[model samples]
Target: MALLHRAELRPTKLELLAAWLPGRAWFGGEAGADLERVAAYRFDDPAGEVGIETLLVRAGAGPIHQVPLTYRGAPLDGAEPWLVGTCEHSVLGRRWVYDACGDPVYAAALASAILADTGQAEEYFEVDGRREGRAPSMAITVEGAHRADVPQIRSIDRVEDGDPVRIVTESVELAVVRRVGAHTDLPGSRLAGTWANQPTPLPLAYASLR
Candidate 1:
Protein backbone atom coordinates (compact mmCIF):
# COMPACT_ATOMS: atom_id res chain seq x y z
CA MET A 1 0.00 0.00 0.00
CA ALA A 2 1.11 3.54 -0.76
CA LEU A 3 0.43 6.23 1.78
CA LEU A 4 -0.47 9.69 0.51
CA HIS A 5 0.19 12.88 2.39
CA ARG A 6 -2.17 15.82 2.03
CA ALA A 7 0.74 18.22 2.02
CA GLU A 8 1.76 21.03 -0.29
CA LEU A 9 4.82 20.94 -2.51
CA ARG A 10 6.86 24.05 -3.21
CA PRO A 11 7.35 23.36 -6.88
CA THR A 12 4.44 21.15 -7.83
CA LYS A 13 4.99 18.04 -9.89
CA LEU A 14 3.51 19.71 -12.96
CA GLU A 15 5.65 22.77 -12.37
CA LEU A 16 8.78 20.65 -12.22
CA LEU A 17 7.81 18.75 -15.34
CA ALA A 18 6.94 21.94 -17.20
CA ALA A 19 10.47 23.19 -16.66
CA TRP A 20 12.14 19.85 -17.28
CA LEU A 21 10.19 18.11 -20.05
CA PRO A 22 11.09 20.32 -22.99
CA GLY A 23 14.76 19.40 -22.77
CA ARG A 24 14.12 15.73 -23.31
CA ALA A 25 14.62 14.37 -26.79
CA TRP A 26 11.24 12.68 -26.68
CA PHE A 27 9.20 15.72 -25.69
CA GLY A 28 7.09 16.80 -28.70
CA GLY A 29 5.49 20.01 -27.47
CA GLU A 30 6.50 23.58 -26.74
CA ALA A 31 7.94 24.56 -23.36
CA GLY A 32 5.39 27.32 -22.77
CA ALA A 33 2.35 25.21 -23.46
CA ASP A 34 0.12 24.39 -20.55
CA LEU A 35 0.37 20.79 -19.37
CA GLU A 36 -2.73 19.09 -18.06
CA ARG A 37 -2.54 16.01 -15.93
CA VAL A 38 -4.32 13.17 -17.63
CA ALA A 39 -3.77 10.36 -15.16
CA ALA A 40 -1.22 8.72 -12.87
CA TYR A 41 -0.41 5.48 -11.08
CA ARG A 42 1.89 4.27 -8.33
CA PHE A 43 4.16 1.30 -7.78
CA ASP A 44 5.01 0.16 -4.31
CA ASP A 45 8.56 0.00 -3.04
CA PRO A 46 8.90 -3.25 -1.09
CA ALA A 47 11.23 -1.54 1.38
CA GLY A 48 8.95 1.53 1.46
CA GLU A 49 11.77 4.07 1.24
CA VAL A 50 11.21 5.69 -2.15
CA GLY A 51 7.99 6.99 -3.72
CA ILE A 52 7.38 5.74 -7.25
CA GLU A 53 4.72 7.42 -9.37
CA THR A 54 4.15 7.68 -13.08
CA LEU A 55 2.33 10.68 -14.48
CA LEU A 56 0.60 11.16 -17.82
CA VAL A 57 0.49 14.76 -18.96
CA ARG A 58 -0.74 16.37 -22.14
CA ALA A 59 0.68 19.60 -23.45
CA GLY A 60 -1.79 21.74 -25.37
CA ALA A 61 -3.06 19.58 -28.21
CA GLY A 62 0.02 17.44 -28.38
CA PRO A 63 0.44 13.84 -27.38
CA ILE A 64 0.27 12.65 -23.82
CA HIS A 65 3.73 12.05 -22.37
CA GLN A 66 4.55 9.47 -19.75
CA VAL A 67 6.92 10.42 -16.96
CA PRO A 68 7.85 7.96 -14.26
CA LEU A 69 9.39 9.65 -11.24
CA THR A 70 10.91 8.64 -7.93
CA TYR A 71 10.81 10.84 -4.86
CA ARG A 72 13.59 10.33 -2.31
CA GLY A 73 14.47 12.06 0.92
CA ALA A 74 18.11 12.14 -0.18
CA PRO A 75 19.83 12.32 -3.52
CA LEU A 76 20.41 9.09 -5.40
CA ASP A 77 24.18 8.67 -5.80
CA GLY A 78 25.47 8.82 -9.38
CA ALA A 79 22.06 9.93 -10.66
CA GLU A 80 22.89 13.62 -10.99
CA PRO A 81 22.27 13.58 -14.72
CA TRP A 82 18.74 12.23 -14.35
CA LEU A 83 17.68 14.58 -11.56
CA VAL A 84 14.48 16.40 -12.47
CA GLY A 85 15.00 18.85 -9.61
CA THR A 86 14.21 19.31 -5.92
CA CYS A 87 10.99 20.29 -4.19
CA GLU A 88 10.06 21.08 -0.62
CA HIS A 89 7.39 18.82 0.71
CA SER A 90 5.43 20.41 3.52
CA VAL A 91 5.24 17.08 5.31
CA LEU A 92 8.40 15.31 4.12
CA GLY A 93 10.70 18.35 3.96
CA ARG A 94 13.21 18.57 1.11
CA ARG A 95 12.87 15.84 -1.51
CA TRP A 96 15.20 14.78 -4.31
CA VAL A 97 13.22 13.88 -7.42
CA TYR A 98 14.69 11.89 -10.29
CA ASP A 99 13.48 10.13 -13.39
CA ALA A 100 12.26 6.71 -12.30
CA CYS A 101 14.04 5.00 -15.18
CA GLY A 102 17.34 5.81 -13.49
CA ASP A 103 16.29 4.46 -10.13
CA PRO A 104 17.19 0.89 -9.25
CA VAL A 105 14.27 0.60 -6.87
CA TYR A 106 11.89 1.64 -9.65
CA ALA A 107 13.56 -0.75 -12.08
CA ALA A 108 13.15 -3.62 -9.67
CA ALA A 109 9.52 -2.80 -9.02
CA LEU A 110 8.67 -2.33 -12.68
CA ALA A 111 10.43 -5.51 -13.73
CA SER A 112 8.74 -7.48 -11.03
CA ALA A 113 5.37 -6.11 -12.07
CA ILE A 114 5.96 -7.07 -15.68
CA LEU A 115 7.56 -10.45 -15.09
CA ALA A 116 5.53 -11.53 -12.12
CA ASP A 117 2.19 -9.93 -13.10
CA THR A 118 1.99 -7.77 -9.99
CA GLY A 119 -0.23 -4.76 -10.65
CA GLN A 120 -0.16 -1.23 -9.33
CA ALA A 121 -0.09 -0.54 -5.61
CA GLU A 122 -3.07 0.21 -3.42
CA GLU A 123 -3.38 3.86 -2.37
CA TYR A 124 -4.49 5.51 0.84
CA PHE A 125 -4.46 9.09 2.07
CA GLU A 126 -4.48 10.54 5.57
CA VAL A 127 -7.34 12.81 6.50
CA ASP A 128 -8.29 14.00 9.98
CA GLY A 129 -6.05 11.45 11.64
CA ARG A 130 -7.70 8.64 9.72
CA ARG A 131 -6.65 6.62 6.72
CA GLU A 132 -8.99 6.82 3.72
CA GLY A 133 -8.97 4.72 0.63
CA ARG A 134 -7.97 6.59 -2.50
CA ALA A 135 -8.99 5.27 -5.87
CA PRO A 136 -6.27 4.71 -8.45
CA SER A 137 -6.17 7.22 -11.29
CA MET A 138 -5.37 4.61 -13.89
CA ALA A 139 -5.67 0.89 -14.48
CA ILE A 140 -2.69 -1.15 -15.60
CA THR A 141 -2.53 -4.57 -17.23
CA VAL A 142 0.57 -6.70 -17.33
CA GLU A 143 1.19 -8.92 -20.33
CA GLY A 144 3.48 -11.45 -18.74
CA ALA A 145 3.30 -14.70 -16.88
CA HIS A 146 3.79 -15.20 -13.18
CA ARG A 147 7.34 -15.82 -12.08
CA ALA A 148 8.78 -17.30 -8.90
CA ASP A 149 11.30 -14.49 -8.50
CA VAL A 150 12.91 -11.54 -10.13
CA PRO A 151 16.55 -10.59 -9.72
CA GLN A 152 17.37 -7.79 -7.33
CA ILE A 153 18.49 -4.55 -8.91
CA ARG A 154 21.06 -2.87 -6.76
CA SER A 155 22.18 -0.25 -9.30
CA ILE A 156 21.41 1.15 -12.69
CA ASP A 157 24.10 0.04 -15.10
CA ARG A 158 23.13 2.19 -18.08
CA VAL A 159 20.39 4.56 -19.27
CA GLU A 160 19.72 5.42 -22.91
CA ASP A 161 17.22 8.26 -23.06
CA GLY A 162 15.20 8.53 -26.24
CA ASP A 163 11.60 8.05 -27.36
CA PRO A 164 11.79 5.16 -24.93
CA VAL A 165 14.14 5.38 -21.98
CA ARG A 166 16.12 2.17 -21.84
CA ILE A 167 17.32 1.16 -18.39
CA VAL A 168 19.72 -1.74 -18.31
CA THR A 169 20.31 -3.70 -15.15
CA GLU A 170 22.31 -6.84 -14.60
CA SER A 171 19.23 -9.05 -14.72
CA VAL A 172 16.64 -7.05 -16.65
CA GLU A 173 16.35 -4.55 -19.47
CA LEU A 174 13.47 -2.07 -19.22
CA ALA A 175 12.05 0.22 -21.88
CA VAL A 176 9.91 3.02 -20.48
CA VAL A 177 7.89 4.84 -23.08
CA ARG A 178 8.44 8.57 -22.88
CA ARG A 179 5.42 9.30 -25.06
CA VAL A 180 2.39 7.12 -24.40
CA GLY A 181 0.95 5.28 -27.42
CA ALA A 182 4.10 5.98 -29.41
CA HIS A 183 6.21 2.91 -28.83
CA THR A 184 3.99 -0.14 -28.63
CA ASP A 185 6.15 -2.64 -30.46
CA LEU A 186 8.97 -2.95 -27.91
CA PRO A 187 9.61 -6.67 -27.68
CA GLY A 188 9.27 -7.77 -24.09
CA SER A 189 6.84 -8.47 -21.28
CA ARG A 190 4.54 -5.43 -21.36
CA LEU A 191 2.69 -3.05 -19.10
CA ALA A 192 -0.22 -1.05 -20.48
CA GLY A 193 -2.81 1.25 -18.96
CA THR A 194 -5.98 3.27 -19.59
CA TRP A 195 -7.63 6.21 -17.93
CA ALA A 196 -10.25 8.93 -18.47
CA ASN A 197 -10.55 9.93 -22.13
CA GLN A 198 -8.24 7.10 -23.06
CA PRO A 199 -10.37 4.01 -22.87
CA THR A 200 -8.19 1.62 -24.82
CA PRO A 201 -5.07 0.54 -22.99
CA LEU A 202 -1.82 1.87 -24.34
CA PRO A 203 1.70 0.60 -23.85
CA LEU A 204 3.43 2.28 -20.93
CA ALA A 205 6.53 0.16 -20.56
CA TYR A 206 8.02 -3.26 -21.11
CA ALA A 207 10.83 -5.42 -19.75
CA SER A 208 13.00 -8.34 -20.74
CA LEU A 209 15.32 -10.54 -18.73
CA ARG A 210 18.96 -9.96 -19.51
Candidate 2:
Protein backbone atom coordinates (compact mmCIF):
# COMPACT_ATOMS: atom_id res chain seq x y z
CA MET A 1 0.00 0.00 0.00
CA ALA A 2 1.05 3.58 -0.68
CA LEU A 3 0.00 6.12 1.92
CA LEU A 4 -0.27 9.87 1.37
CA HIS A 5 -0.37 12.79 3.75
CA ARG A 6 -2.10 16.14 3.61
CA ALA A 7 0.99 18.06 4.58
CA GLU A 8 2.90 20.95 3.11
CA LEU A 9 6.01 20.76 0.98
CA ARG A 10 8.53 23.55 0.63
CA PRO A 11 9.09 24.36 -3.01
CA THR A 12 6.04 22.27 -3.93
CA LYS A 13 6.22 19.49 -6.55
CA LEU A 14 4.77 21.66 -9.28
CA GLU A 15 7.14 24.44 -8.35
CA LEU A 16 10.11 22.14 -8.68
CA LEU A 17 8.84 20.65 -11.93
CA ALA A 18 8.15 24.11 -13.31
CA ALA A 19 11.80 24.96 -12.89
CA TRP A 20 13.12 21.55 -13.86
CA LEU A 21 11.01 20.29 -16.78
CA PRO A 22 11.85 22.80 -19.49
CA GLY A 23 15.54 22.11 -19.09
CA ARG A 24 15.22 18.44 -19.99
CA ALA A 25 16.11 17.30 -23.48
CA TRP A 26 12.83 15.46 -23.81
CA PHE A 27 10.63 18.36 -22.73
CA GLY A 28 9.36 20.35 -25.69
CA GLY A 29 7.37 22.93 -23.77
CA GLU A 30 8.45 26.30 -22.49
CA ALA A 31 9.50 26.38 -18.87
CA GLY A 32 7.32 29.37 -18.14
CA ALA A 33 4.11 27.81 -19.42
CA ASP A 34 1.54 26.66 -16.95
CA LEU A 35 1.78 22.96 -16.08
CA GLU A 36 -0.92 20.91 -14.45
CA ARG A 37 -0.59 17.57 -12.75
CA VAL A 38 -3.44 15.86 -14.48
CA ALA A 39 -2.77 12.34 -13.16
CA ALA A 40 -0.36 10.31 -11.08
CA TYR A 41 0.44 6.78 -9.95
CA ARG A 42 2.58 5.13 -7.32
CA PHE A 43 4.55 1.92 -6.63
CA ASP A 44 5.10 0.38 -3.26
CA ASP A 45 8.53 0.26 -1.64
CA PRO A 46 8.50 -3.13 0.01
CA ALA A 47 11.10 -2.01 2.51
CA GLY A 48 9.14 1.19 3.10
CA GLU A 49 12.26 3.33 2.75
CA VAL A 50 11.49 5.30 -0.38
CA GLY A 51 8.56 6.90 -2.16
CA ILE A 52 8.03 6.13 -5.85
CA GLU A 53 5.65 8.09 -8.03
CA THR A 54 4.94 8.75 -11.67
CA LEU A 55 3.24 11.97 -12.71
CA LEU A 56 1.38 12.87 -15.85
CA VAL A 57 1.69 16.58 -16.44
CA ARG A 58 0.42 18.75 -19.20
CA ALA A 59 2.04 22.01 -20.22
CA GLY A 60 -0.20 24.63 -21.69
CA ALA A 61 -2.00 22.88 -24.58
CA GLY A 62 0.85 20.61 -25.55
CA PRO A 63 1.47 16.87 -25.20
CA ILE A 64 1.36 15.06 -21.89
CA HIS A 65 4.57 13.94 -20.17
CA GLN A 66 5.44 10.99 -18.02
CA VAL A 67 7.87 11.69 -15.21
CA PRO A 68 8.76 8.94 -12.77
CA LEU A 69 10.32 10.15 -9.55
CA THR A 70 11.78 8.78 -6.35
CA TYR A 71 11.95 10.49 -2.97
CA ARG A 72 14.55 9.73 -0.35
CA GLY A 73 15.63 11.07 2.98
CA ALA A 74 19.21 11.64 1.86
CA PRO A 75 21.31 12.12 -1.24
CA LEU A 76 21.63 9.26 -3.73
CA ASP A 77 25.24 8.44 -4.39
CA GLY A 78 26.47 8.82 -7.98
CA ALA A 79 23.07 10.15 -9.03
CA GLU A 80 23.70 13.83 -8.51
CA PRO A 81 22.82 14.53 -12.13
CA TRP A 82 19.29 13.16 -11.69
CA LEU A 83 18.34 15.24 -8.67
CA VAL A 84 15.19 17.24 -9.41
CA GLY A 85 15.56 19.30 -6.23
CA THR A 86 15.19 19.08 -2.48
CA CYS A 87 12.05 19.86 -0.57
CA GLU A 88 11.02 19.92 3.08
CA HIS A 89 8.01 17.73 3.72
CA SER A 90 5.97 18.54 6.80
CA VAL A 91 5.54 14.88 7.60
CA LEU A 92 8.77 13.36 6.30
CA GLY A 93 11.16 16.22 6.95
CA ARG A 94 13.68 17.01 4.18
CA ARG A 95 13.62 14.86 1.04
CA TRP A 96 15.79 14.47 -2.01
CA VAL A 97 13.81 13.90 -5.17
CA TYR A 98 15.38 12.38 -8.26
CA ASP A 99 14.32 11.22 -11.66
CA ALA A 100 13.40 7.57 -11.12
CA CYS A 101 15.70 6.40 -13.91
CA GLY A 102 18.74 6.66 -11.70
CA ASP A 103 17.34 5.57 -8.38
CA PRO A 104 17.86 1.85 -7.71
CA VAL A 105 14.79 1.54 -5.55
CA TYR A 106 12.50 3.00 -8.17
CA ALA A 107 14.16 1.08 -10.95
CA ALA A 108 13.78 -2.20 -9.15
CA ALA A 109 10.23 -1.57 -8.07
CA LEU A 110 9.18 -0.55 -11.55
CA ALA A 111 10.84 -3.55 -13.14
CA SER A 112 9.27 -5.84 -10.61
CA ALA A 113 5.85 -4.45 -11.31
CA ILE A 114 6.23 -4.81 -15.04
CA LEU A 115 7.66 -8.29 -15.03
CA ALA A 116 5.15 -9.45 -12.45
CA ASP A 117 2.22 -8.00 -14.32
CA THR A 118 1.25 -5.97 -11.28
CA GLY A 119 -0.78 -2.82 -11.58
CA GLN A 120 -0.30 0.44 -9.73
CA ALA A 121 -0.23 0.27 -5.97
CA GLU A 122 -3.39 0.85 -4.01
CA GLU A 123 -3.51 4.22 -2.24
CA TYR A 124 -4.66 5.45 1.15
CA PHE A 125 -4.43 8.69 3.06
CA GLU A 126 -4.04 9.48 6.71
CA VAL A 127 -7.13 11.19 8.07
CA ASP A 128 -6.65 11.94 11.73
CA GLY A 129 -5.48 8.46 12.76
CA ARG A 130 -7.50 6.50 10.25
CA ARG A 131 -6.50 5.27 6.81
CA GLU A 132 -8.94 6.13 4.06
CA GLY A 133 -8.93 4.56 0.62
CA ARG A 134 -8.45 6.66 -2.50
CA ALA A 135 -8.81 5.99 -6.19
CA PRO A 136 -5.75 5.00 -8.20
CA SER A 137 -4.74 7.30 -10.97
CA MET A 138 -4.28 4.70 -13.67
CA ALA A 139 -4.13 1.01 -14.57
CA ILE A 140 -1.23 -0.72 -16.35
CA THR A 141 -0.73 -4.00 -18.16
CA VAL A 142 2.56 -5.65 -19.07
CA GLU A 143 2.38 -8.16 -21.87
CA GLY A 144 4.63 -11.25 -21.78
CA ALA A 145 5.29 -10.62 -18.12
CA HIS A 146 7.23 -13.31 -16.30
CA ARG A 147 8.34 -13.71 -12.71
CA ALA A 148 11.89 -12.70 -12.04
CA ASP A 149 14.07 -10.93 -9.52
CA VAL A 150 13.93 -7.16 -9.89
CA PRO A 151 16.67 -6.02 -12.22
CA GLN A 152 19.28 -3.58 -10.99
CA ILE A 153 19.83 -0.49 -13.12
CA ARG A 154 22.40 2.00 -11.89
CA SER A 155 21.81 4.94 -14.23
CA ILE A 156 20.43 6.01 -17.54
CA ASP A 157 22.70 6.10 -20.58
CA ARG A 158 20.52 8.36 -22.69
CA VAL A 159 16.95 9.38 -23.56
CA GLU A 160 15.52 9.22 -27.02
CA ASP A 161 12.21 9.20 -28.80
CA GLY A 162 10.86 5.74 -29.78
CA ASP A 163 13.27 3.88 -27.52
CA PRO A 164 13.46 2.79 -23.93
CA VAL A 165 16.05 4.53 -21.73
CA ARG A 166 19.08 2.27 -21.64
CA ILE A 167 20.88 1.59 -18.42
CA VAL A 168 24.51 2.53 -18.01
CA THR A 169 25.28 -0.69 -16.20
CA GLU A 170 27.50 -3.25 -17.95
CA SER A 171 26.06 -6.62 -17.02
CA VAL A 172 22.53 -6.23 -18.33
CA GLU A 173 20.85 -4.08 -20.91
CA LEU A 174 17.67 -3.17 -19.00
CA ALA A 175 15.60 -0.49 -20.68
CA VAL A 176 12.45 1.44 -19.81
CA VAL A 177 10.16 3.27 -22.20
CA ARG A 178 9.98 7.02 -21.82
CA ARG A 179 7.92 9.80 -23.36
CA VAL A 180 4.86 7.55 -23.67
CA GLY A 181 1.94 8.06 -26.05
CA ALA A 182 -1.36 7.07 -24.51
CA HIS A 183 -2.89 5.90 -27.76
CA THR A 184 -0.34 3.47 -29.16
CA ASP A 185 2.14 0.73 -28.38
CA LEU A 186 5.84 0.30 -29.14
CA PRO A 187 7.33 -2.35 -31.33
CA GLY A 188 9.90 -4.70 -29.71
CA SER A 189 8.51 -3.81 -26.31
CA ARG A 190 8.84 -6.59 -23.73
CA LEU A 191 6.02 -5.11 -21.74
CA ALA A 192 3.21 -3.13 -23.39
CA GLY A 193 0.02 -1.53 -22.10
CA THR A 194 -1.72 1.70 -21.00
CA TRP A 195 -3.18 3.89 -18.30
CA ALA A 196 -6.81 3.46 -17.32
CA ASN A 197 -8.09 6.46 -19.23
CA GLN A 198 -6.20 5.83 -22.44
CA PRO A 199 -8.46 4.54 -25.18
CA THR A 200 -5.95 2.06 -26.53
CA PRO A 201 -3.18 -0.25 -25.43
CA LEU A 202 -0.56 2.44 -24.97
CA PRO A 203 3.02 1.45 -24.38
CA LEU A 204 3.43 2.41 -20.76
CA ALA A 205 6.77 0.73 -19.94
CA TYR A 206 9.32 -1.78 -21.23
CA ALA A 207 11.18 -4.52 -19.39
CA SER A 208 14.86 -4.11 -20.29
CA LEU A 209 17.06 -0.99 -20.23
CA ARG A 210 20.23 -2.08 -21.94
Candidate 3:
Protein backbone atom coordinates (compact mmCIF):
# COMPACT_ATOMS: atom_id res chain seq x y z
CA MET A 1 0.00 0.00 0.00
CA ALA A 2 1.10 3.57 -0.73
CA LEU A 3 0.65 6.25 1.88
CA LEU A 4 -0.46 9.50 0.29
CA HIS A 5 1.12 12.63 1.62
CA ARG A 6 -0.94 15.73 2.12
CA ALA A 7 1.98 18.10 2.05
CA GLU A 8 3.30 19.59 -1.15
CA LEU A 9 6.53 18.79 -3.00
CA ARG A 10 8.86 21.54 -4.05
CA PRO A 11 9.66 21.49 -7.74
CA THR A 12 6.86 19.03 -8.47
CA LYS A 13 7.51 15.81 -10.44
CA LEU A 14 6.41 17.29 -13.77
CA GLU A 15 8.90 20.11 -13.44
CA LEU A 16 11.78 17.73 -12.85
CA LEU A 17 10.79 15.36 -15.64
CA ALA A 18 10.39 18.25 -18.06
CA ALA A 19 14.01 19.19 -17.52
CA TRP A 20 15.23 15.60 -17.61
CA LEU A 21 13.14 14.04 -20.39
CA PRO A 22 14.83 15.67 -23.37
CA GLY A 23 18.19 14.05 -22.55
CA ARG A 24 16.77 10.53 -22.44
CA ALA A 25 17.42 8.01 -25.20
CA TRP A 26 13.77 7.12 -25.85
CA PHE A 27 12.44 10.65 -25.88
CA GLY A 28 10.42 11.35 -29.01
CA GLY A 29 10.16 14.90 -30.32
CA GLU A 30 8.21 17.46 -28.35
CA ALA A 31 4.51 17.23 -28.95
CA GLY A 32 3.51 20.72 -27.88
CA ALA A 33 4.42 23.61 -25.64
CA ASP A 34 3.40 22.13 -22.29
CA LEU A 35 3.96 18.70 -20.79
CA GLU A 36 0.98 17.13 -19.09
CA ARG A 37 0.80 14.07 -16.88
CA VAL A 38 -1.88 11.89 -18.35
CA ALA A 39 -1.85 8.76 -16.18
CA ALA A 40 -0.04 7.33 -13.20
CA TYR A 41 0.28 4.14 -11.16
CA ARG A 42 2.32 2.67 -8.35
CA PHE A 43 4.03 -0.43 -6.96
CA ASP A 44 4.40 -1.02 -3.26
CA ASP A 45 7.67 -1.64 -1.44
CA PRO A 46 7.13 -4.43 1.06
CA ALA A 47 9.44 -2.66 3.45
CA GLY A 48 7.53 0.60 3.04
CA GLU A 49 10.77 2.54 2.75
CA VAL A 50 10.91 3.17 -0.95
CA GLY A 51 8.36 5.11 -3.01
CA ILE A 52 7.70 3.61 -6.44
CA GLU A 53 5.60 5.36 -9.08
CA THR A 54 4.99 5.08 -12.84
CA LEU A 55 4.02 8.16 -14.80
CA LEU A 56 2.54 8.40 -18.31
CA VAL A 57 3.02 11.88 -19.65
CA ARG A 58 2.37 13.67 -22.93
CA ALA A 59 4.25 16.63 -24.29
CA GLY A 60 1.39 18.58 -25.79
CA ALA A 61 -0.32 16.04 -28.11
CA GLY A 62 2.62 13.66 -28.54
CA PRO A 63 2.77 9.98 -27.73
CA ILE A 64 2.51 9.30 -24.04
CA HIS A 65 5.85 8.55 -22.39
CA GLN A 66 6.17 6.05 -19.60
CA VAL A 67 8.55 6.98 -16.85
CA PRO A 68 8.92 4.90 -13.69
CA LEU A 69 10.44 6.56 -10.67
CA THR A 70 11.68 5.68 -7.18
CA TYR A 71 11.92 7.95 -4.16
CA ARG A 72 14.31 7.44 -1.24
CA GLY A 73 15.22 9.15 1.98
CA ALA A 74 18.94 9.04 1.29
CA PRO A 75 21.18 8.40 -1.68
CA LEU A 76 21.03 4.84 -3.00
CA ASP A 77 24.39 3.17 -2.76
CA GLY A 78 26.22 3.14 -6.12
CA ALA A 79 23.31 4.91 -7.85
CA GLU A 80 24.69 8.40 -8.08
CA PRO A 81 24.69 8.26 -11.86
CA TRP A 82 20.96 7.48 -12.11
CA LEU A 83 19.83 10.36 -9.92
CA VAL A 84 16.96 12.34 -11.42
CA GLY A 85 17.28 15.14 -8.88
CA THR A 86 16.56 16.06 -5.28
CA CYS A 87 13.43 17.77 -4.02
CA GLU A 88 12.17 19.05 -0.69
CA HIS A 89 8.91 17.71 0.57
CA SER A 90 6.61 19.90 2.57
CA VAL A 91 6.51 17.09 5.09
CA LEU A 92 9.29 14.56 4.38
CA GLY A 93 12.11 17.07 4.07
CA ARG A 94 14.58 16.01 1.35
CA ARG A 95 14.09 13.11 -1.03
CA TRP A 96 16.53 11.59 -3.50
CA VAL A 97 14.77 10.49 -6.65
CA TYR A 98 16.07 8.22 -9.38
CA ASP A 99 15.01 6.43 -12.51
CA ALA A 100 13.24 3.28 -11.33
CA CYS A 101 15.21 1.27 -13.91
CA GLY A 102 18.37 1.70 -11.85
CA ASP A 103 16.83 1.03 -8.44
CA PRO A 104 17.16 -2.43 -6.93
CA VAL A 105 13.98 -1.97 -4.94
CA TYR A 106 12.11 -1.03 -8.10
CA ALA A 107 13.65 -3.88 -10.05
CA ALA A 108 12.68 -6.36 -7.40
CA ALA A 109 9.10 -5.09 -7.15
CA LEU A 110 8.64 -4.88 -10.94
CA ALA A 111 10.15 -8.30 -11.50
CA SER A 112 8.03 -9.86 -8.80
CA ALA A 113 4.89 -8.25 -10.21
CA ILE A 114 5.43 -9.54 -13.76
CA LEU A 115 6.57 -12.99 -12.68
CA ALA A 116 3.75 -13.44 -10.18
CA ASP A 117 1.02 -11.73 -12.21
CA THR A 118 0.23 -8.74 -10.06
CA GLY A 119 -1.08 -5.24 -10.61
CA GLN A 120 -0.84 -1.80 -9.09
CA ALA A 121 -0.53 -1.34 -5.35
CA GLU A 122 -3.48 -0.39 -3.24
CA GLU A 123 -3.31 3.25 -2.23
CA TYR A 124 -4.33 4.94 1.01
CA PHE A 125 -4.19 8.24 2.78
CA GLU A 126 -2.93 8.12 6.36
CA VAL A 127 -4.59 10.66 8.59
CA ASP A 128 -3.39 10.53 12.15
CA GLY A 129 -2.77 6.82 11.67
CA ARG A 130 -6.17 6.20 10.08
CA ARG A 131 -6.03 4.74 6.58
CA GLU A 132 -8.38 5.81 3.78
CA GLY A 133 -8.49 4.22 0.36
CA ARG A 134 -7.41 6.23 -2.68
CA ALA A 135 -8.13 5.67 -6.37
CA PRO A 136 -5.56 4.89 -9.06
CA SER A 137 -5.36 6.58 -12.46
CA MET A 138 -4.59 3.45 -14.52
CA ALA A 139 -5.28 -0.27 -14.44
CA ILE A 140 -2.85 -3.20 -14.89
CA THR A 141 -2.87 -6.89 -15.82
CA VAL A 142 -0.40 -9.73 -16.18
CA GLU A 143 -0.77 -11.85 -19.31
CA GLY A 144 1.19 -15.06 -18.68
CA ALA A 145 2.77 -15.35 -15.29
CA HIS A 146 5.33 -17.77 -13.86
CA ARG A 147 6.10 -17.75 -10.18
CA ALA A 148 9.64 -17.08 -9.03
CA ASP A 149 10.41 -17.82 -5.42
CA VAL A 150 12.39 -14.83 -4.33
CA PRO A 151 13.55 -13.69 -7.76
CA GLN A 152 16.84 -12.08 -6.90
CA ILE A 153 17.84 -9.02 -8.94
CA ARG A 154 21.62 -8.92 -9.27
CA SER A 155 21.90 -5.94 -11.62
CA ILE A 156 20.00 -3.80 -14.14
CA ASP A 157 20.90 -1.75 -17.21
CA ARG A 158 19.60 0.14 -20.22
CA VAL A 159 20.71 -1.90 -23.24
CA GLU A 160 19.39 0.34 -26.03
CA ASP A 161 18.64 4.04 -26.26
CA GLY A 162 15.44 4.39 -24.23
CA ASP A 163 12.58 2.32 -22.89
CA PRO A 164 12.67 -1.51 -22.55
CA VAL A 165 15.12 -1.55 -19.65
CA ARG A 166 16.82 -4.89 -18.87
CA ILE A 167 16.77 -6.45 -15.41
CA VAL A 168 19.22 -9.24 -14.58
CA THR A 169 19.50 -11.57 -11.68
CA GLU A 170 19.90 -15.36 -11.45
CA SER A 171 16.47 -16.20 -12.88
CA VAL A 172 14.96 -14.16 -15.72
CA GLU A 173 15.76 -11.47 -18.29
CA LEU A 174 12.95 -9.01 -17.56
CA ALA A 175 12.47 -6.10 -19.97
CA VAL A 176 10.58 -3.24 -18.37
CA VAL A 177 8.80 -1.34 -21.11
CA ARG A 178 9.18 2.36 -20.49
CA ARG A 179 7.30 4.42 -23.06
CA VAL A 180 4.55 1.85 -23.66
CA GLY A 181 3.65 0.79 -27.19
CA ALA A 182 0.32 1.38 -28.88
CA HIS A 183 -0.77 -2.15 -28.13
CA THR A 184 0.38 -4.73 -25.61
CA ASP A 185 0.50 -7.50 -28.22
CA LEU A 186 4.09 -8.49 -27.55
CA PRO A 187 4.58 -12.21 -27.29
CA GLY A 188 6.04 -13.38 -23.98
CA SER A 189 4.80 -10.27 -22.27
CA ARG A 190 4.12 -11.09 -18.63
CA LEU A 191 2.25 -7.88 -17.95
CA ALA A 192 0.14 -5.19 -19.61
CA GLY A 193 -1.85 -2.17 -18.55
CA THR A 194 -4.27 0.48 -19.79
CA TRP A 195 -4.16 4.15 -19.11
CA ALA A 196 -7.34 5.50 -17.55
CA ASN A 197 -7.77 7.85 -20.50
CA GLN A 198 -6.88 5.22 -23.12
CA PRO A 199 -9.31 2.62 -24.40
CA THR A 200 -6.95 -0.35 -24.88
CA PRO A 201 -4.30 -1.99 -22.83
CA LEU A 202 -0.72 -1.65 -24.05
CA PRO A 203 2.26 -3.90 -23.59
CA LEU A 204 4.36 -2.78 -20.66
CA ALA A 205 7.11 -5.41 -20.58
CA TYR A 206 8.20 -9.02 -21.08
CA ALA A 207 10.22 -11.52 -19.08
CA SER A 208 11.89 -14.62 -20.62
CA LEU A 209 15.61 -14.22 -20.99
CA ARG A 210 16.90 -17.06 -18.93
lDDT winner? 1
Which residue window of length 10 is worst by lDDT in model 1?
A: 143-152
Model 1 scores a C-alpha lDDT of: 0.91
Q: Between which residue pairs do clashes occur in model 1?
A: none
Report clashes for each candidate as comma-separated counts.
Answer: 0, 6, 1
Query: What TM-score does model 2 achieve against the real structure?
Result: 0.84
Looking at model 2, the pairs that clash are: 173-210, 174-208, 174-209, 174-210, 175-208, 175-209
Residue-level lDDT tens digits of model 3 in 1-210: 788888888889998888888788777747445788888889989889999998888786567788889999999988877789999999899999898877878877887787776668998988777998988888888877567574666566433335566666556666777676743554454677776657677877777646
Ranking by lDDT: 1, 3, 2
- A best-first ranking of the candidates according to their TM-score comes to 1, 3, 2
lDDT of 1 by residue, 1-210 (tens): 899998999899999999999888789975578988999999999999999999999898888999999999999998998899999999999999999888999999999889898889899987888889998889999886668688888888899989898999999999999889988888998999999878998999999998
Candidate 2's C-alpha runs over 4 A off are: 148-163, 168-172, 182-197
lDDT of 2 by residue, 1-210 (tens): 988888899989988988888877667664467988867788898889889998878788767777789999999888888899999999999999998877777766766676665667889998888999998667666776466554555454443333355544432344555556743444323544445567575565665434
Please, what's the RMSD in Å of model 2? 3.1
